[model samples]
Target: MIIPDAESIAQARSIVLAALSEAHAKHAGRGFDPYEFGADVSPLVNAYAALTILEKEEPSELAEESSPED
Candidate 1:
């Protein structure tokens, strides 16, 4: 799992929204099914939710310090 910074989180949200929009368009044209969109996005949504919670709980210093550079 990647620990996303604020920028990465924003990018991920954008990507997810874009994917959902594309899925909707494809379904409208009968190229893909609506149900498949939910299946495809469920994991990304779940992971994002988990990451949001984790970010809130994480200590700021833990992110600021680098273990390898220690």
Candidate 2:
């Protein structure tokens, strides 16, 4: 039963995205193909997916919906 706080989840999302971006940059240098690092980077894909679910379920900001008069 691991419950993460909102702040922690947000921080994790940011860190994961940053790490993925850095990893991609490293893979692109010296003619290195991304496929060669698929195994190592695949977990990031899952992280993105998990974050998406969390974001949708627990959005940081919610817009108020206006109701039309009948």
Candidate with top lDDT is: 2
lDDT of 2 by residue, 1-70 (tens): 3445677888998999898888888887757775776866789979988877766763323221233347
lDDT on C-alpha atoms for all candidate structures: 0.66, 0.72
Candidate 1: pairs in clash:
none
Evaluated against the true structure, the overall lDDT of model 1 is 0.66
Clashing pairs in 2: none
- Backbone clash numbers for all candidates listed: 0, 0
Residue 41: error of model 2 in Å?
1.7
Candidate 1 residue spans exceeding 4 A from truth: 31-34, 47-70
TM-score per candidate, chains pooled: 0.52, 0.64
Give the range of the ten consecutive residues with the poorest summed lDDT in model 2: 58-67
TM-score of 2: 0.64
Evaluate residue 60 in candidate 1 and report its C-alpha lDDT on the 0 to 100 scale. 63
True-structure lDDT of candidate 2: 0.72
Best by TM-score: 2
